[model samples]
Structure formats: C-alpha cells, structure tokens
Target: MFATATRNFVDEVDRGGLLIPVRSLNDSIALLTVVVSQKGFWFWQKPKHVPTDFTLNDILTGDIPITPVLSETDFIKYNGIYGDSIQGSMDATFIHSNMNAAGKDSSKLELSFGSLKKDEVDVRQLLRDTKNSVLDMSHSLIKQTQKKRQVFGLVKERIVTSQPCSVTEEVQQADQCGGTLGFCGPKSPKVSLKDNGSLSKDSNVTMEIPTNTTIAYALIDLEVKHDGHYELCLMSNKGGFEVDSRTQKGLLGVTGAVSNNPDDVSRLAQELKDLSDHFQLLSALPASSKASLLKIVTDVTEDRAALGALQSVLNRMLVEKSANIADVSEAHKQSIQPVLEMLKESECGSVAETECSASLLSALHLITSALDELTHESLSALRACRSPAVLKITQLLVHCLCESGESPASATNVGVLSEDVLANLEHLFTSSDVNLQRDGDAATIQIKQLQKPGNRPLIMFIALRGLHSLAQGV
Candidate 1:
C-alpha cells in the first residue's frame, strides 16, 4: 500500500506538506525520492568555471546574468524546521527501554545488533546516554545559531513609571528615563483626580516599583501651593522678534535703486509713508506697545508727528538750497526733493491729512534751526518743546533715511558709524526709553553723550547716514 501510494505521490502531493520535492528532482521522469531531515542543505554542486570578480554595476545593468541555485519553493522547503517520525521513533524506543529496565539492574541488561555480541550495550544505560547526547547537541546548535538582531529608528522600549518619589529621588529616576521630566519640588506630588481636588495631608508616600504606566503620564511634577486650579505658563525674558525676509529684500532692492537713480528715492519714501498710513490704527492700540520692537516699527512705520516734522525739514533743505545736511551729498539732496514734494502734497492736498499745515509750518522753523546749526543751544531749544514728540519724530526720520539708503555717511567712509553711536542708535527702536541700554552700557561716556536731551537725534542721524552708505555697498 505504501509503495502504490508513493508512485502517484507526485500528482496527488500538497505543496504545503512535509513531502515537498526539491527543484532538481521535481519534474524528472525517473522516480527520484530525496528525504531531507535537516533544517537546511548545502549547495553540493560547484560552478564548472568560476567567473572573474565584477562590480555591482555590472549586475544592475544586466551585463552579468544571475542564475539562482535554488527556487523559492525549494529554498523554503530546505531551510524549514519541520518535525518528522524519526525523533518520535527514537523517543518511543527510549521509553520502551526505560519501562523494561524498571525494578531491575539496568546495567546488567544488554542489547545486541545483527547477532553480534561485540556491538551490544546495556539497554537502559544506552537509552539514557542517547537522550542526554541528543539534548546537549540541540542546546549547542541553538546557542551557536542565536544572534542579537539590530533594528533602525526610534524603537527603544520605554517603561513609564508613576512611582511616588521625593525631589531628590526624582533626579536619579529622571536620569534613568533619559531626563524626560520637568522641575520638581521638595514634597512628593499629590495625584489630583479632578481640576480642583483637595490636597493630601499625609506626608508618608508608599515607595515601590510601578508595574504599569502608559505614555500619557505627566512630565511635570506639579505641587499646587493654594490652588483652585493651578495655571501653568511658560515665560521668556527675551522679546519675540521676527523679520520678514521678503519685505527686507524688497527694501534692500529699493535702496540699491535709490542710490543709482535719485527718482527711485521717492518710491522708497512712498513705501515708508504708505506703511505708516496703513498701520496707524493697529499700532496705536495698547497691545501694540507691548509687541516686539521690530514688529512695532514694521507695523507702525512713523507716527503722524514724525512724518509732518520730516516733511517740513525736507522742504526747508530744498528751498534753502543747502549744499548738504551733515554728510548728505548733492545727489542725496536731489533725491530728497521729490520725497519732500510728495510729503507736501500729502500734508495739504488729501482729505486723509490730519496734521494741519499751520502746525507743520510751526514745527518746521524749530527743526530748520536745529539742522542749520547743530549747536547744543539750538537743539536744546527744540528739545524743550514736545521733547517726547521730538525724539519720536527724529527716530522715524532716521529710520526713513536708513530705509531709503540716504542716511548720513561717516568721515571714515568704510563703516556706518562709531561703535558707541551705533549702539546708542539701536536703543531708539528697540527700547521703550531711547536712553536705556539693553547691554547695561548706559553709564559709559559715549552713551551718556548720545543720551543727552538734545544730542539724541544728531548722533542717531549720524548713525543713520552711515547705515545708508553701508547698505548700498551691501
């Protein structure tokens, strides 16, 4: 019956069973049966002629043809750990021998193979030795084959624990968990169930290794001092400042054009004017004052008073035909003339014009005298009337000059301004008080000189012009 069934086994066999055939013998006309007892088989056949070493590129480009020694089905069958009747038969024989050796001297029992006494051995002892040998060989094979697999990416197995611990103990625990913890207080944190849960009076906390914890455990060890619901906030001493790279690039381009072509200077002035007009409402609000200096300046541009004062000064410079104001060249004067005309038209012609022509004219005389002769006496006189307004207007004017690439250039011609003057000028837009220094350098003589009630605008103007020259080169 076995031989008859084996004959037709090729046609009736299932691929998912233990009796699967190897690739070489699968479709042969002759009855070729090969039983594989081991998990894997070595390739016994070698190539007739070994090829020369070739680059991986050759294989990728199909220059080298690849012929696999075994198909997928055959490889899987050969490398599979499948159990057969051999192991079961060995176990059954051992069990039968042990049963027979019961209540007898097992060493005295002998076994003969093929009627040969020389090949005989004690049955019980031989069975025990065979079982031990098989077990030892299997253990050795498993140990030799075992390997520690390496995996990529963030696959670290974390065991989160909510164990109650003191602040000192938490430091060690946090280190153990890769420092995924915030600040902790002196006492063990009270585990609150509700938003307004009552605090625990008990000081003693049971300490034990936590068995289970999820990833949703709290990182912050909060201790509510007197809470109805403790509010947590993150604060920073440094102000939040951001620059619009696109707008900055556009301003840079405009400045470059203004330096080469004086007519383009009016466009620069117009942009500044438009910015002020658009953000006047938004910048005047209380919240806007608390915003970062860059944000406020970019949003607010210059106030109405500043624009009015600047327009007045530019008009006088044009009418008087002054060779230059400080380091402003004749070319710069030609540039200023168009901007002045635009400001003048905006001041008087438009319905949106808020500042009366009278006030602007009045402010013009004071500003004109200050610019004409930059003496302490003349500047002091101008500073006495609307001191805060004067500083604001001056800062805006300097900012406009810098933005327009027409700022006062220095004697050095290489740099914008002296370090002291540059530092002092930065405070005007950055701080609430122009006199204040962020770097604690207000006590320095240079800073003190620039911070004087009247010297603020003159020093800043010097810095502004230098910045303009430097910007052009940039």
Candidate 2:
C-alpha cells in the first residue's frame, strides 16, 4: 500500500510538469521511508506485511529501480533536467558540515574516499554531536551577554558619580573667577569718629564701599579725649585696628614701642612743641604790635588753629604715655608737612628781589625778634626750623653789616644764638670783610682793618653808596 501511494505521488508530480523527474522523486521517497521505518517505528506501528529492510545504500546502489514516468520532452518543457537541483541540495549538507567544523576546531578534514571510509562515519551520532555543540554554544553566548550587561552597569555607575564631581569643580572655579572680577566679596568698613567723641558700638559697620576700596584721606580728631583714656578703633573684613584688644595692647606696650622705633614720634613732638610756642607768644602779644608782624601772625594762626589744638592733645597723650601715641603724632605730621614745605619754598628768594627787599627784610626782622624772646623749649623748636625764610633774614642782615662796614649790635640778639644761626651768619660773611663769631648770647660782626691807607677812602665811599641804596628802598 505504501509503495503504491508513493508511485502515484511521483506520477502526479511528473504530470504537473514540476521539473521533478519521477526517478529522483522515487529516490527521495525511498530515503524518507528508510528513516521513518528505522527511527520512528513506534509512531507508525508498521504492519507485518510492510517491508522493513529498506536502507540508503540499497537505494544508491540501484537495487531499487526508480523509473521516470515523464518523457524527456516534458522534462525539457518544464525546465531542463531537475537532477542538478537534487545534486545542489546534497552539496549544501556537506557545505554546512564544513562551516560547522571550521568554527568548532582547528583540525582539517581531507575530502577523500579513503578518509571518509576509514572514519566509519555514523550519521545519527554525528547529528547528535552537532546538536550538543549547538546547545553548548548557545549557553556560552547567554553567559557572555550577562557579563556584558554587568560591565555596562559598572560603567554607568562611574559616570553617575563623576558627573557631580565635575559639577562641584566647575562651581569652585566659578567662585574663584567671581573673586577676580571684584564681585561677591566682603568689603571693609570706613569708620569716622562721631561729634560726641565715641565710635558706634556696632561690630559689623558696613560702609557703602566696594571691595578693596582705598582711603583717599583720613581726618582724625584727637582733640576730645574721654577721661584721658581715649581710644579709636578701625574695623574691616580684611584687617583693622581694635582698641583695648589683645593685639592692640601688645603693640602699644613699652617693649612694642621701642621695637617699632620712636624717632618719628620724637621728631613730630618737637615740631608741634615749636609751633605751639610760636603761637602762644604771638597770641600773648598785643594787637597794637607792628603791622607786618601782626599780619603774618594773624594769617597763620587763623587758618591753622586746628594744628595748635592737635598739638595740645598730642602733648597730653605723650605725657600720659598713651597707647599708639606715636601713630597719632605721625598722622598729624603728615597732614602739616606739606604746608611747611610750601612755606619754605615761598620764603626762598623772598628778599632777593630789589623791589620787595626792604619790606621782606623788615618782616623777617620782626619774626627774628619774636623768636629771640621765646623760652628754651621754644628756642629749641625754632632752631629745628630749616625754613629758607629764617636763613634769608640772617643773610640780609649780614649783607647790610658788610656794606655799611658797621656793626648793628642790636640785630645780633634778634634770635637764639644756636649753631644753625651762627652757621648762617658765617656763611653770609664768608665773602665779605666782616668776621662773625658767637659771643655769649649774641653774634658779633667785626670789619677787617686793611693795611692799605691810600685805598681806605675808596672802601669808605663804596660802603656809603651801598647804604644809600638800602636807605632809599626803606
């Protein structure tokens, strides 16, 4: 019954002109019959009458005749012989085996009849081995996929951690850049003493100043002392002074002052004392004094009364040994030093001009007379003054004495007979016949007596002419 059905199916395929020859169809049916009968006998339950001796070798050796029912013309009409197609399908199986072997191992297989026979090939066993290899390869591929997933997860975690670190670093860099641009920073307070002689007790005094602001000028009023315990403090974000603080106390102590040098303080004290004495003497003098002297005193005293007040405050602080007293004195000196320099420049060449020489000389003489009556302290201060005004006066007086060949004994006591005053006198007379020397509290000038009796009259005449010119200017 099976043979008859298979023959009928082949005949139908040939009649339909499917290009499948009956012989090749019969060979395929015989091979399928062999595999089903041998491997799947339980499923079919083969009848006793059906043949069970079929094999692939019997079919290949032509022990089973597979006659083509279709004519050659019919086969050509469908599409040439279909035997090539069957042969190509068989070649594909060998090609698949070669590819699998290449991937599985390095050993080469010779494609020869002897090698094939010598191997005693088993088709079922080969198929089973190939299936097991495929299963093992699939299992290994699944494990490799899982490992890749773990590595990807680690890389993602690292990236997540690194992002915040990079952001933090960027924020720090931005803050530094802002500082350079002068933004977002604390500023120092500018403290000024109030009229009530007290600083505001607020610790964080915020001045409307920008960061890194510089001081243009600082005006400190030391006139009002609080019970002889005056204290001034400056506070700032960067750094500033704090009164009565440990740091400040350390700096103001005796050892601290000595270490910091007190020469500048001493010099400033001397200057202030000299100015105070001069003002005091002038203030004591009656307003009915000489016009030129009164004018000079009024002009300086009216415009500079603050200096005198500051001087008094400084003297008290020095005597009491106040903290940072030198610092206060130095500040005052800096404020007044420029004015003194200007005065010195103004006084130079003041009496050199023939037009204003006499008036300038008279004004200088009045100053000299005032200086001469000053106390020892005042005298010391005046001696320290190196203004050209004082020196020029000495020069003019000496010049007059030389021209007249007469000693004005009254002028010799016009100022303190200090070394500086005597030096000026000597300098003025160095090129003249007059010889100057300090005599007790006065400077004496003596005319040289030349030995040429015949030239004495000529010398007298020149002296008279100089005196006449000076008198005319007066």
Candidate 3:
C-alpha cells in the first residue's frame, strides 16, 4: 500500500510539478509553492540570474520556456534554506516563463509591481507583528522551569520550543520593531493574565537543541543570575558541541514569553530587542533584496536568531564589497526612511537607529556618489542583492554625484550651477555663521578689496552672476 502511494505521489508530482518551465530568474512557481505546500513540489532551477526589471512570477502565470538551471553556488544557497528538495506528487498545470529574454526584457517589478510591493509590505508587517508580540509579553520571569537541564545535541537538529508569556493588552506601538514598554526589569515586570494565558508564574519552557549541545553541556560550569521569575541565561561549550539557554525559547529574548499559562515574560524583552535589530538591517538593505530578506527575517524572527543571520549578511556586503547606499532604488530608500525618523522622534537612545541616522543617509549618498564616480571606470558582472542588508547598502548610494553617476559628457554641465541651487544655498552666507577661521584667516569666504567698498565686492567662491541670484532674490 505504501509503495503504491509512493508511486502515485511520484507520478502526480512529475505530472504536475514539471508542467510549466520558464526562464524565471526569481521563479514564480516557488512563490506559489510558499503559500501552498500542502503536498510537495520540485524546483530544479535556482535564481542565479539577476533580472533587469522583470520577475519570473509573471511568466509562470503565462506560457513560457523552462528557466535554465541556476549556477552551482546559488543553487546550493537558495536550496539549502528555502527548498525542501524532496520528491512528492501533486497534479497541476506547469508553466514556464519566456516573456523575459535572458538579456532583453522589461523589469518584472514594473509589470506586477502590485504583487511585488505587496510582498514587501507583507514582510514589513510580519516584522512589525513579531516585534509587537515579543514586547507585549510580560517582562517577568518563569519562577519554575523543568530542571532536567533539558539537552539535545547533534550536528543538525533544532531544539524547538514554545512557551506561554504574559503581557499587557495595552501595548505601545513602537517603530518598525513594533510595540514595547519601558525597560523591563527582570525583578518585577508588568504582567496581565487576561491577555496572555499560555504562561503561568511557574511557566514550563521546553527547549530543543542539536546533539552538539549535548556535548557542550558536559564541558564547563556556568553562572546565572535570577530576579524573581526570570532565570538568568547561560552559555557553555563542551568538546564537540555547545549549550545555550539564552535563546528566545530559553529565557533571554522572550520577556514574558511562556506557554499558555497566563504569566511568563522571561525572554520576551530580549526577543523584541533582537527583532528590532533585524528590521534595523532590513531598513538598511536595497529595495530589491529587501523583499527576499524580509522573508528570511520573518522566518528567523519567530525563532529569535534573525540578528545573527542579518549581521552575517551585513558583514558580507559592507566589508566584502564596500557597497554604499546609492546602489539601490527609491523603493528601498522609502523603506528605511521611516525607521530613521522614528528613532529620533521616539528619543530612544537605546535604539541602534540613533547611531546610524546621519551616517546611514550619508552612506547612501556616498555610494550613489561612488557609483557616479565609477561609471567610467569599468563594469563587471552584476550580482544583485538578495537580502535586506544588500538592499539597504545599495539604496543609500543612489543620490551621490560621483564618477559612477552622470558624466560631464552625458549632455553638458554648461549651466553648472543652476539658479535653484543658488537659491537654496543662499542662507549659508546670511546665517550669521561668521565666515571666520580660528586662525583669523578669511574663514568661510575669501574677499578682496575691490576698487572700493561701494563697488561690487569680489568674492573668491561666489561669482558675480551667482551672487546676483542670491542678492536679487533677497
């Protein structure tokens, strides 16, 4: 019976899975599968190609050719994470995208932008929801946790866990990281049982771990601090493995997080903190990869490991390529702008955005300037961003006037300084910011004794024509 079912499954998947093939860089079939993975599906191709403006999603809905196989690297990366890479059966119409030629095609983002934008919005919302959930959790501790020193270890296995946590129904909606309260004191946290029931004062947390952790557990002794319900978190490493109880599932990230027992806020606060960090990275990435990273962030966020992964991506982009913000689009620019504003408005010095504010935007401009600077140097194969970190770095660089940007020969810089520019900068001269150097040398501007004081004063920086605009406007 099982053998027959297996055969049926293979035949069904083979019939339905391979139905439509196309040249989709971001294979749309995968998108559909993400929503509907009731059965199983096979995706032989990977997204090795960075499409111009097009997406493969549109092609899958229509008739198209089979998308070529992905490069070995991408195939491994994309598959290692999202793809299940198993065989199963489901009868359905197969479609492959062809509308987009390998090199010549309109942008997919342009065609089905509604869906793409919606996908991004959904990611943003998911991030918000995850954060809010953690913050709303009570800031207390779990007075009691089963102390068998729960352990699991192996090279590959998630020590999954879920517990109840308490929280006030009235949660203050924060920025992208979402709702939160003032700093939660582990000694005493705000708890409301009616809102959260999965946790109790003596909440029981079930932690899952890989076998490697089992080895770590055997190694060293660790110290822990406790304040009321929240037990202190501990980390240690043994010979072949490591042990960590600070995971959200442990008592670190989830403050009031607990089972449905009504009141438990052990790791919830930490969970919210980590969540905020993930969005920090998200808001920094380019618009293109912002969507992809949004998906990954949403998944890892639930587990509270998003920051680790996000930081890895950031290191890759910033250190590896020295990529700046100007590389991405306005779409990405809009995405991070809010978080920056929120940090200042909320006066959350604790927030990382505070430190990254001006620098982030400046970096964006710097990169754009760099791109403008490098435009004439030389071009190479383009590796598009696939993560939020990549998106943020690229987006920040688009605004600069660098060699990589518009060239003098593109048209003409004859009207080098436009009237508009002059008008905007006029205040610089009149702002009472004495143009003086500490050394008493001509500070802001160098002025010469023109024939006489009443005569037109000749300034070193501004020309008479440039001055005319500023003076006349005043």
Candidate 4:
C-alpha cells in the first residue's frame, strides 16, 4: 500500500506540484532543503530548494531562500520520496513547525564514529611516547650487551703507557755495584736578607734542580723451567754440596689431579683405590679402634672443612697402606719456608726447632696407631737409618701439621730402638730375605747424616711412624 501511494504521489507531483501557502513558502522550502541535505542527496546535485549561497545554519534555521524554479513548482519531488507525506498533511504551517521540532530533537541525538576523545590521539604526545620507548629499548640493549660480556669474561683491551719521563737509561751489570760516583765541588753559600733574623719583603725565589737525577730500567726476565725432577736449592752455614739431594718422581699423592703425567694419574687412581679400601677397613675394624681414630682426627684440627681436606691427605699418607710416595721431602721444606715465616708472625714469635719434638712424635703416633707393634719397631729402626720412605712421610706430616690451627699434643715418648729389635731386623737384611737381598748378599744399611738445616730427627721420627702404617706389610 505504501509503495502504491509513493508511486501515485510521485506521478501526481511530476504532473502538477503541490501548492504551499505564500506565508509558509520559505519555511516549507527550508524544511525541504534540510531533508534533502540530511538524506545526502544534495552532495551530488545542488537541489533548487537549497541555494548555492545558503549555508547549513540558514537551512537548519528555516531561513534559506528558495530558487525561482523551486518557487514556481512549490518544491521538487525530493527524488519522489516524502512527497506524499507533505501532500497529505492537513496544515502547511503545522507540517513546517513539526519538521523544525523534529530537527531540534534529532540535534540532541549526538552520533559518534569512535569512542576515543580528540586529545587521546594527539600527535605530539604520541611522538614523545614513541621516542621515550625507543630510548628505553636502546638502554636495555646496552645493559644486556654488557651483561653478556661479563658472563663471557670478556675484557676490553686498554693501552697501558708508562709515566712521562724526561730521561731514561738502559741498566748494565756493572751498575749493580753502585753507579759511578760524582764528586761535588764546594760552593759559596747564598747571602739572604733574613740572615739578620728580621722580617723582609716577600720575594719569589727559584729552586735549583739536581744535576745527578737519573732514571734507569733493568731488563730482567726470570724464566722458570720445569723438568721431571724437582730441585730444592738451600743455603746453609756449612755448604750447598754437603747434603745428598735425590731427583723426585711423580706428583704429590694428594695433588696428583693437577699433574699431566700418565704415571701420576695411575698412581693417583691407585692411591684413591687404596684410600677407599682403608675406609672400608675402618668400617670393618673394631668399634674401639674406630673411636680412637675418630678422636685422633677430631683432635688434629677444629675446623671441620680443613679437617675434611686434611683427613683425605693424611689418609693417603698415613692410614692407606701402599701409598704412592713422591720424593717431596726437600721439596716441602723449600716450599713451606713461606708458611713457616707466616707462622713466625704469630704471638709465639717462632716455633722451637727440635730434633724430635714430643708434639710431633705424638701426632705421628696418633696417625700411625693402626699399625702393629712389630711394624713400629721396624719403623724406629728405619728412622735411625734415615730411610727415604720415612723422609717422605715426615714431609707430609709437616704439611698436615701446618694445616692444623692448634699445636699438636706435647705428651709423647719417642723411645729409642732396642738392640734386640735391631738384631731381629737383621734377618730381613740377610740373604734369606729374597726381596731385600736381590743379589743373594746381606743388604748393607747406608746411614748418611744430612747437615740440612732444621729438625732432621723430627722428620725421621714422623716419617718413620707414618711409613709403618702406609707401607704394605711393613
């Protein structure tokens, strides 16, 4: 019905336009202009009802002028739509009033395309935000780069230059005996106005530079050479050649991991195996023995961490039988001189040097308590003769002693070897003992007294006790 009515209205308006009252003509034309403009049809075709000179405000106010053609036809068909509505209305003025009222009501219906306010998309603020974010990212990247360098232990190389100097001279060997002396001739004393012990006017006085000022550099590079043999150079009151020095083999049993030699590694493995066996033996030993061992270990050092480390080293040297002995006797004495110097820094001033200190003997007894009585007697005999095995053991004992914070027990009886025990020890030296008498002759015991400084007797005693337990079937 609506389509039929719209078509009929369009046909009628095309034949003869609907007449509006002269009084309501301009209002009718303005209302029609608003409708046309609101429908967006005036964008393509400039409607005759809306004049080129008419602004949107004029149209909305119902004050725009109608073209002559639009006035003649009352109004164009408005694309043949809404024509019937206006034509069918009862009052022209009422229609105009209603249209204006509807337009005002529609003006209150605020339409928006997006939710964001105008200030939200401000270009200046957006640019500043973007710039700040970029700077932050660059700083973060720089920090990450520095972190990576630190993690990789990368050190930036820097050019190191010596201090600026006016003079330099290469040193010579003869200059070590004090450089050539220069004789200074007598000079006349300068006469000062203040020599009369009175105040005088201040005057700038220049200082004279010394004529003998010299800067010299000695080019000396001490290259340390490593050979298979360990050498300990010692200075004594007697002579350097007085003591017999032997070439050391393998690594210090406890420090074998640092050695590159395959033999050292093999020895270290064997030592470790022996250590494991010793622990197993300890576990199997009587409870009393274990208690005694524990007490001795606890008494050795108060520091638990140092105790653990010392226990491992001591076990390899004392508890574990068949330890791979390195000839670190003289080596230790040379190396530990610094430690002894440090020890001298203590309030005690210096540790008393004795041939066989009771404290050292007590420590040795505690370490070698696992050995049999017969072995102890044999060890005493070996000590008397100054055996290398005993010497090595003594070096290890000194190392362990240094590791301990407290002084060892001073109560001990390092008794001399009995004649009977020595006589009984002779059987091993006889041809009957195949191991000792390899050439089928009595083994001669060579006793060379080393004039080496320090307590030789103490070294022999400690090493003897340790060797008793450490040597296989001693």
lDDT of 1: 0.23
Model number with the top lDDT:
2
Q: Which stretches of candidate 2 lie over 4 Å from their true place?
A: 1-389, 392-396, 399-404, 414-417, 431-433, 449-474
**For candidate 3, lDDT tens digit of each residue in 328-405?**
345444333333333233322454764554334333222222121111101010111112222222122211112232
TM-score of each: 0.16, 0.15, 0.15, 0.14
What ranking emerges by lDDT with the best candidate at the front? Answer: 2, 4, 1, 3
**Which pairs of residues collide in candidate 2?**
none
Clashes counted in candidate 4 amount to 0
Can you give the lDDT of residue 472 in candidate 1?
A: 22
Pairs of residues clashing in candidate 1: 407-465, 408-465
Report the C-alpha lDDT of model 2 over 338-368, residue by residue, as the tens digit. 3233222323233354333233333332332
* Candidate 3 lDDT score relative to the true structure: 0.21
Per-prediction CA RMSD (Å) = 41.5, 58.4, 30.6, 52.3
